[model samples]
Target: MKPQVILFDLDDTLTESKQKVSDEMAQVFSRLLENNKAAIVSGAKFEQQLNQFINFLPKDSNLKNFFSFPQNATECMTFDGKIWAKEYSFSLSNEEITEITNALNKVLEETKIIENEISYGERIENRGAQITFSALGQEAPVSAKKTWDPDQIKRRDLQKRLEEIIPQYEIVIGGMTSIDITKKGINKTKAVNWLSEKLDLPVSSMLYIGDSLFPGGNDAIVIQTGIPVMETKNPKQTTGIIDSFLKENVV
Candidate 1:
């Protein structure tokens, strides 16, 4: 089961919440490259995640790859810091974005959550085509976010309710409080499967590391395709799982 390719989830798996890769995580990635190249599969925009981890990884390794901008992002590169093959992204009109934002804004005003809701990260992202709804604004506190949607029950309910009002949009739960709204095909599973096919690897040969795998979690659908999944309890523990997978398969 030696992985020809290893894919990592950016947030909470390789790094702390809404933070850059830690020195310790960097070391693990370095180890991964010694035998097999690794790729990052994330819901963040392609440029955003790359900006976060590029400094940590060796730029000379052409084997390194990344899959970013989940749903709307379609480019997969061979570590040139650029993509060779870009899958198409579904986009929404400016009016659509404005309307959605306005609705969410109204909700925020009514609930008065905006005052207490400290934005820890980036939200309202335009991945060339898809749109996101990041609760902590992409930089929110993990403890606060957990408190925001303890079981993701609230988010799921919100998604269903939103769909009733805006049936035209496709809403998918993201790595954090964010929600990805795009065309029907915009999902991490499709992106991962596409990358696997392009790499000539099977779903089983590749292990996907992600934090949000619970019901209505973003990475949950990615697991639905029969891909072998390595669930990460925390970023600090990711190295251990990666080590075990590498040892179990490579050794």
Candidate 2:
């Protein structure tokens, strides 16, 4: 049976990291939204979500069925016909932010991963609800991000270190080279539960698509909700999955 709603991870799953959605993927996604509720949950900030995914959709697409759960679902935005409105947002306190940044810096220093000469843009970004540490820097090229941690070994090591330092926060590997830190319970599982109540649907009625569903990956948290999931290697695989859903006329 087709899922009543589809949940997706933004980067890598729907589009290449930090890149805009392709025209082909946009068309298919628009069609998916025509009859099914869909949501994007990512560790990225809301602006990155818009620039990379939402802005590429066709004008006539069903915005009402679209939802944005940025910052690893620490924040949620829903379309209200006229505009996207924030449904709820969880923010880190000043002290929490300071501690997280300081811990990240300590980890970087201990790991000796910071290469100032090759790094691009900000290495640490405070997204209000979440803090992210991008090993290759936020503005690193897509190719660089991909090669930086293909096996996720390097990131797993960093994640382990961060966890040891800030056990109070939620820390997980995100995107190609980013590690996302959120409030203790503010992870993708929260998004799944929120949608289940908001849509008045059972968890089994939803299907989640993501690239990072493996152990220690950010998307792994959703597994606790018991939502069915499809794992993809990249955007191309995600497009194919969407195509199959459309072909099957699965809403």
Candidate 3:
């Protein structure tokens, strides 16, 4: 079915695999904004995600053009402050945060995760309420990342163990050997669901495009609700999807 509203995944999708959102994607975003039906539903936090694409946007434009549906916080509008079009954020307790941090650090420190020169970023990001345990330390090479965790079994196991230590928190595998820990009842799928209901739309009427849609992958949970899914690969493909969606539907 054609969707009424379309959601986006920033990283490997609109941006290249390297997570760089190019000028081409920026133009596509401007087009989507003109249509007023595009939103970014990504794993990155609002502040961090906005930092990536905000420069490409016009200075006078409102920040609501993009949406950052992080696992821990309610969806944050790109330019808008914390409370945006809607609120579905979940904050972690101090004790829960400390406990998970210690456990994740211990596991990553003890194991040798794949690291490649193409890799960029960090091994750990305590995004305030959420903690990301990255095997590649956020700097593993692209080629190495593709082979780092093909089966996802290892990461899944890590999630299970982490959950055991802090059952109250939400644990899920994410981008290239990274595990995102959030407060209970928080997940990408949940964030989308919350947004859909608040916007008075149906689940089936939305499509989420993300690179992490594979099983045990961070965005996999959204597939459970039967929302349309798109595998994020090239930025051009994301542009094509958005253009196609616009051509097929009026909004």
Q: lDDT of all predictions, in order shown?
A: 0.66, 0.89, 0.68
Identify the runs in model 3 with alpha carbons over 4 angstroms from their true place: 58-65, 71-75, 78-88, 109-122, 139-144, 249-251
Decoy 2 TM-score against native: 0.94
Q: lDDT winner among the candidates?
A: 2
Best by TM-score: 2
Candidate 3 per-residue lDDT, tens place, 106-152, comes to 66455434433233677667776688877766656767777877788
Clash number by candidate, in order: 9, 0, 12
Candidate 1 Cα outliers beyond 4 Å, as residue runs: 62-78, 81-88, 93-99, 102-123, 245-251
Tell me which of candidates 1 and 2 scores higher on lDDT: 2
When sorted by lDDT, best at the front, the candidate numbers are: 2, 3, 1
Q: Can you write out model 1's per-residue Cα lDDT over 1-251, one digit (the tens) per residue?
A: 56666667777888876577877777667666766757776766666666677566655544434444444334454444454445455567788777666655655455454466678656566665567777778666677776776666656765776676566766777765777776555566765677678778788887777887777666787777788877888888898877675676553
TM-score of each: 0.79, 0.94, 0.82
Candidate 3 residue-pair clash tally: 12
Which of the two candidates, 1 or 3, achieves a greater lDDT against the reference?
Answer: 3
The Cα error of candidate 2 at residue 163, in Å, is 2.1
